[model samples]
Target: MLLIHQLPPKPDYFRVKIWRRLQTIGAIAIKNSVYVLPFNDEAMEDFQWLRREITAGGGEATVCRASFVDGMSDRQMEAFRPLADHGAASERLPGTGKAPMNKRGRTWITRPDVHVDRIASAWLIRRFIDPKARFAFGEPKAGMVRFDRFDGDYTYEGDRCTFETLLKRFGLDKDSGLRAIGEMVHDLDCKDGKFERHETPGFERMIAGVVKRNPKDDARIARGAELLDTLYESFPAAQQRSRSH
Candidate 1:
């Protein structure tokens, strides 16, 4: 969960300034008058700076930890490294929230519209055609898991456009644990599907969730996808973790 706080009344100009600064450090605005922010040193620092800005304008200020989404977990914090590791994901910083961090960046690869395809293709290409991830297309298999599973009805469909079908033909529906993992994946994957203008930076948070909540596994995809043949039978623990947060 991310931490957030309400802002005190300030000039519109000052409020916008604070809003942009918080956003630069990965804060989301849930209410127009109140901005949702991550609970962390950076966000706290941003809030302090915000306090100064508002006070300078002779306006009131308040910074409180949001119960619903004040901040992410410690594990999620580590996921930022790999995300920033990507050149494109790095460019989003220090600016307005309209574009991806970088133009040549690979942020769009994680889009919900592309989620199903990306997982299936990455699994197939890496394990079968391009083992060792030689023909790289996605993030390295270090802090992430990849597979198509059931999450509501949308994520259950598996790879929609893949030439290698892993759904009805594969009978993944019979799997019991598949659904749970799917729900988390669906919620996390489509982070961009219903994305609002204010939630553009949310991709980083979703990816952070995926990596943090996923159970660490070895040799899942690149090793001929054999790991998924057995391990993919179970859903990840993301839902439970998310709910607790």
Candidate 2:
């Protein structure tokens, strides 16, 4: 399903707000001002909200339930959501591909701008979800699994951040050391005052440095992964103790 909107120009604020809203629902921008999402009840509701907002913002919008024939472009055909954990059923449209993938070789998608939660989530994917996972940015495509992009299968849900959701959903929550890192990510990303770890300030500075140095998403992720690996190894005794069975 696609909720396409043609917004008025000049103000820019309207476009920004609409783009953010579409991002929240994991809508891929197939073309300028045209976004795509899987047809579902939740997706429909999200589009309804967006439609209302767009209309109220002096822009015109419409939601359409769509299906594609064969020979669609890869980007046009890509799935809009992340795949479920192993053994879980994956819903797919005809000609989209097989459902419920058993392994994690799929390309892990996210926004290009890396941050605390996004970087941490990417590290988690390589370290725990899929070691050989490939990565891309900006709207998930068919056959690719996305995280940290609006309603992604592995992204934020309810009160949980993407990192926390990945940890819990993939059964990685048992690792106290990872959970410790997750607390930092949650506090930094959400600013919700949920965790009070003292290492946050220094860690955030380190992340900022990495992001500043590595301008490209692929490069930043590689650098970020190294830092996360080191941090996991150097967790304090309390966190290490939590790792014990």
Candidate 3:
């Protein structure tokens, strides 16, 4: 949810900036000075950045998540394309504020000496998909979710990285900015002449620095997640660029 207010008779530039920012993140205006987007890391960060912008521009803003929202007409709902098919199995999901089945007691396995794809995938799992998810470095066990490794359920298929595979399988590819991030991860991981975002080299270098300083897998993952948050924040601008091209 988005809340915004400006010193009355708001400046036109501030108003347009807020609107464009929300539009970039695919938010739908629910009311004047209010907008909404599905709950996710991307949405949360988008709102945070907007809040800072608002405050800096002599306005007020607040963003929050709601467990329940109703009263949207069909047209309003059309603002966002359907994400995933919530099939019959989705009914078995835990109630709000609870961990889903995939996240509960699940051990995700990947190769040791984590790099771009593995670290980003771990960050994605922890940030968006699973809060209680645990990661280990090794071969896949009898009941483990393995990624970026051979013989894994969600390993690379052709040019895609494990992160891209997970995003598709999890029905999270709807976030255009995330798709851009996946492109960068794919190019950096496979180096297969795929995507060439200007930020790729610096991001990879930052990851290498983190890995060199923090030898532990868990430490590297934590540091990597921080970096991804920064990258994710920057992708919305790229989202606009991709649309123009």
lDDT of each: 0.36, 0.70, 0.65
**Which regions of candidate 2 are displaced past 4 Å?**
1-101, 236-245
Tens digits of per-residue lDDT, candidate 3, 151-216, equal 456665433567887777676788877788888887666554458888778877898898889998
Deviation in angstroms for 180 in model 3? 1.6
TM-score of each: 0.26, 0.58, 0.54
Best by TM-score: 2
Better of 1 and 2 by lDDT: 2
lDDT of 1 by residue, 46-144 (tens): 455455445545666677764644555445544442232111110111111222212221211222222323444445444333344432233434422
Q: Backbone clashes in each candidate structure, one number apiece? A: 11, 4, 0
User: Can you rank all candidates by lDDT, best first?
Assistant: 2, 3, 1
Cα displacement (Å) at residue 70, model 3:
76
**Per-residue alpha-carbon lDDT of candidate 2 for residues 60-157, written as tens digits (9 for 90 to 100):** 98989877775454354446443321110111111111224354787988766777788888898887778889889887778888676543666654
Candidate achieving the largest lDDT: 2
